[model samples]
Target: MSNLNLSFACWDYDRIQALTNGTVQAKGIDLNWLNMPVEETFWRMMRHQEFDISELSLSSYLIAKDRGYPNFTAIPVFMSRFFRHSGIYINKHSGIEEAVDLKGKRVGIPEYQLTACLWIRGILHHDYGVHPSEMNWYTGGQEAPGRVEKIKLTLPPDINIQPINDEQTLNQMLESGDIDALIAPRAPSCFLNGSPHVQRLFPDYVSVEKDYYERTGIFPIMHVVAIKDEILEEHPWVATNLYQAFVEAKQKVYDGFNQTAALKVTLPWFVSEWENTRQLMGEDFWPYGLEKNRKTLEAAVTYSYNQGMIKNRLNMEDLFAQSTLEAYTL
Candidate 1:
């Protein structure tokens, strides 16, 4: 088997450390991964289709599907149970204790894309009964001008957004009570949990989130992996080999913390949200089980579709090769 290049997302060190391992080296699989920003990764993929396989965001996947990209399917890997995608951060001194407290308050965010802001607002309005736009919303951040002619053609026009220039200034603004809430994705972010200015607004993570989404058709995206259909048709062995390698690597990292020596290697990689990694999965979470992954993926697709980000419903079959999980050891 030839070396496979995996284009992946910016997961703050924890997930990165888990997936890059000896199993991948032993398999002769080279993960030539490009570390790009969360949103740009998809834009780059759409433009060049450079990587052999990679993780994709749903917005990117929808754009790809609409553009007639072939043979791409999402194999469910991780189930992000928390409000993992879009976080609501309030000033630590603001006395904001819950998600509902942000009502009629000003908020600052980096970008206003289809997936991130849209779903956040949909949940706020449909589920929580708070209108996000009515809140004094600020969308700031400089976008790298689109260079690819074709990709630019496919994307919607920019929405007058200018991302805040400096993290310090944003921090100061939050400290000064200029922005009531800070909304953005994690990693390279001033987010709720990690940001000193903000505290976790909600106590019950999973229950509150599930309740919100069940009432409103909005759910946060964890992450997704996709392979080009052309590559699968041309090289069938790639699926089994790569999937097994990832499965092994994922388990190896998970199992490492249980051992004293391996804990030395893995302790630094544990992010706050990922401290529950071992607890996140039950005793039977390893071996790439299809049942749990399938349930998570189907739920995600249903929510994204219902919210109109997916344009139409996508099934497990449309998005993945179901039998491929069988190829991967549980």
Candidate 2:
């Protein structure tokens, strides 16, 4: 029989470049890679289930699963992970000199349920004693107006979330001192443009993030690979196959980084940076698989539950395909 054909939508990342470029292929399947911006992929997938497999927001996926609305299941292939400390932008005039100062402040977010914002909120609450209920929240597009949450939310009474006016964007609000700070995966335009009004909450976020990882071992996960439930029901083996393929593709990236004849990446100090990262985080720094990421995953679930994003605190095993929970040893 011919191999199964499926559409997989995700952003083009170096780790998965092999699969996108046909250097790696999933066994028993022919993937039709759809290279799309993460925001578009997430919106379309969450709203319409438009692809066979897609990169999904971890926070939004949990919300959907909790609501029992989407027929989707995930594998352990985390497509995007980041340290969210750098994403927290603040107005210089907002009097928010530290994370603790965020209490009682007005904070803007691209969306209430964004994975990046979820991690930021969780870290702030857990580490800095700043609860979500302590501050007011405004949600809208970071650079454009009219952006809204992909899935509707009915948060608890304590969480104060509101939408900005259709005519206003979070970037403008932050620059004009209309909002105190912004938490998002992407930097606001004003901060990028070096507007005197905007700055990162943690100016030395690199050091802060490293310290966080050393202490907590939680390198926040932002996106996961999700497959349609219908496909899983039809081809149960697809999960393991896809998971293995993603692992192989990621290994290719690791192998490329080991080459020192000439820098595989464009960074002038790529070798030193790679060595420093390996020394800090170990050989497989950007790790895949459920077992390798359990602590981080558990933290995310706990955050989701405490923040009222999910009705129940889901068990870590329930979040991934059962087949993906283990791998065969050679």
* 1-330: candidate 1 lDDT, tens digit per residue: 466555444333333454554334425456665566645656556667765676666555654664567347555454222354235657777766666677667676554443454456555655566655356655554122222222322212222223454443444456567777766554223442266665545545566665554563333554566777777777665666666555665666566555554343534765533455334544543324445455545655554554444556665655555556565534
Q: All candidates' lDDT scores? A: 0.53, 0.91
lDDT of 2 at 166: 96
Global lDDT of model 2: 0.91
Give the clashing residue pairs of candidate 2, or none: none
Any runs in candidate 2 off by more than 4 Å, and if so which? Answer: 328-330
Provide the lowest-lDDT 10-residue window in model 1: 142-151
Q: Please give the range of 10 consecutive residues that has the lowest summed lDDT in model 2.
A: 321-330
User: Residues 1-330, candidate 2, lDDT per residue (tens digit)?
Assistant: 899999999998998898888899999999998998999999999999999999999999988878777889999888999999999999999999999999999999989999998999999998899999999999988888999989888888998889999999999999999999999999887888889989999999999999999999888899999999999999999999999999999999999999999999988999999999999999988888888898999898899889888999888788888888866222
Query: In candidate 2, how many Å is residue 288 off?
Result: 1.3
Q: How accurate is candidate 1 locally (lDDT)?
A: 0.53
Best by TM-score: 2
